[model samples]
Target: MGAHRTSLTAQLFRRMPVGRRPQTEGGLKRTIGLVQLVGFGVGATVGTGIFFVLTEAVPVAGPGVVVSFVIAAVTAGLTALCYAELAGSVPVSGSSYSYAYATLGEVVAMVVAACLLLEYGVSASAVAVGWSEYLNQLLDNLFGVRIPHALSYAPEADGVVNLPAMVLVALCAMLLIRGASESATVNTIMVGIKVGVLILFIAIAATGWNSDNLSDFAPFGVAGIQAASATIFFSYIGLDAVSTAGDEVKDPARTMPRAIILSLIIVSTLYVAVAVTAVAAQPWEDFEGQQAGLAQILEDVTGSTWPSTVLAAGAVISIFSITLVVMYGQTRILFTMGRDRMLPPIFARVNPRTLTPIPNTIIVAVVVAVIAGLVPLNWLLDTVSIGTLVAFMVVSLGVIILRRRAPDLERSFKVPLYPVLPLLSIAACLYVISGLALVTWIVFLIWVAVVLAFYFAYGFRRSTLRQDVDDEEVAP
Candidate 1:
């Protein structure tokens, strides 16, 4: 029994092979650079939550939501640095899951995979739901007809189903099935539209800024600020998406770190600007249960519908892209796990014509669509935040472990301040995670438990690497 257990431990701790060189012989094409890297980071980071999170956060923190944004940014920035180091070293597609697998062990990788699945699936669904709200707002503006509340929201929002959100997910899935690609150029255009609309909101909202709104800042005290910080943390979830491209990024040693820092600064600044301008334009108390909060603020400021219309239209387009990107991330993560035999082989199967993971994409789309149709947006957002915070902490720890375990490994990017930055990253993630509601934590724990149970029941016995090990021992 002791020998058996030892063998299992060795198998679990085996590191995945590092792919340090570009695969030029019929492999993935490397074509992105620093500018495109920053673009990707900014585009992924500035979606969905910013469009609707104030409705859920403002009542808790009042005007202090700006402070909340800063708190979340600090934590996310720290983790992005850690992510940069690991991503530059590993240069794999699974993001945190890949990092953990390389540094920790197979079981830990499975756990990280569960966390990532939560992050991507919930983030995509939350973004889709946000898109649904904006789509309704845009239709109202353009055609003077709106999707009825009954078909536009989940049960928590006192509606039958969020049909529009489900429809959005279904549409994105079809696009994925047809091998839709968001090239660097296309991503840049989407990023421009998103940033342009946000800038327009700030410019208009700044015009109506009043100093009185600042007076009641921190009305709910430190605890409230922390709670709101945890909620808004969802806004910064995609910053690591930048680091994931390290494999293809040019001069990754210098470019990866710079892009991560610059993009975080840009994203955080925009978020703070939006929060400050929003609170200044209207009392924070009025934000609760507000649909299309940003657009509504603009309408209230100018007493005209034109600015709101434009903002709504921009959100509709940009958030649709976000949904697609996050869903693609989800599918790819599952494909990696399936390839490892941690999941059924079907998830790893790709269509020869499209060269995409069709079954994996379908499964992800179905799950996200169901959640978008049934669950409330705020619930999905908080759940996503919790999972992402945990994953970020894991990645930070992985950086430290890899540094200690493989001191001779070639690393393009390394975290500065040695253990200090990675330690701070872990601490910051934990502190913010503490601010989440008990219910969110409970739900997260239950979800993770379910994934682990599935892994033990199926993954342990069927892992391809384990099978290969057994076959080798038995031969000759």
Candidate 2:
């Protein structure tokens, strides 16, 4: 009986061999370079996170949203380092899921995959929802006819359907179906346009800066700041998306870490600059229930519609890239899972001409588009934050575990300060996670439970790792 119990324990924690997925035929092509890789990170991280988040975060934190951005940035910076090391070391498709399978075993890997679905999949839907808002603003600016509320907003927002959001998701899916390299090139251009537009906002908004807005910086105090920090951490969701391109990244050891760090710096600067400029331009009390976001702020400050038009135009283009890269990450992770037989084989099947997963992208797009068309945007922020924070905590822990288990492992990037940095990464994630509301926590727990139940019933028996274990026993 003791021996049988021990055998069951071994089966439960079995790890997949490294580089195993890349060994398969018709695998992802390693064509992404440093510039395009940074584009993927920035493209995915910079979008509605900054453009749409202020509408929700400012109401919660008031002018203290600046502090919230700092806290979230620090936490993201720490986790980004952890991700960089693992991406360089493992250099595979699944990001943290691949890392966990190599160190923590199958159960933990499955949980990581669930977190990733929330991080990439749900966030893509959330950003698409944000896209609809900017698209309305852009239409109003260009054609003088905004999309009607019935066709523009989600059901939760009292609209019949979010057609614009669905259209954005579909467009991104089509671009992704073409090829990764082509998508990256287009994203790079969009990134450039968006960054320039944000700088334009700062330059113009700074002219109207009133010192009086700083009077009540922390109306909600520590709790408000923490809550806002958790909410806006969604901005950094795509930083790790760079690592999902593990199989397709050129000199991943060098490129992945560079892209992650570079994008974090770029995103952090823009978020803080935008937050500070917005708060300083208008009173914190005016930030509540704002729907039009940065462009509206520009209109009020400049007393001219053209500035709003320009900002909204940039947002429309940039947010499209965000949804594209995030959805891209979602498909790649599922592709790896499908390769491992953790999911249906169709997710792993790549189109020979495009060398991309067409069916998987289509499946992901349909589900995400449905979500974008139905759910409210604010709820998505909390769900995405908790999932990403938890996933980051897992990655930090995985970093320490891997170092101990394989001290001789060669890594292109190592977390500076060793265990201390990884420990702080875990602590930072916990702090941000604590700020999430009880309802959000309940939802997150329930989602994780459902994924675990699926894993036990299906993944446990059908996973390739399970087959390998049974074969090993029979061989002896």
TM-scores for all candidates: the values are: 0.93, 0.97
Candidate 2 off by > 4 Å: 1-6
The segments of candidate 1 whose C-alpha lies over 4 angstroms from its true place after superposition are 1-6, 20-37, 183-185, 243-259
Across 374-470, the per-residue lDDT of candidate 1 in tens digits comes to: 8888778888898899899999999888888888888878888989999999999889899998999899999889998998899888877677767
Clashing pairs in 1: none
Candidate 2, lDDT over the whole model: 0.89
lDDT (Cα) of model 1: 0.82
Give candidate 1's error at residue 171 in angstroms. 2.4
Write one digit per residue (lDDT tens) for candidate 2, span 215-281: 8999999999999999999889878799899889888878898899999999999989989999999
How many residue pairs collide in each prediction? 0, 0
Q: Which numbered prediction scores highest in TM-score against the true structure?
A: 2
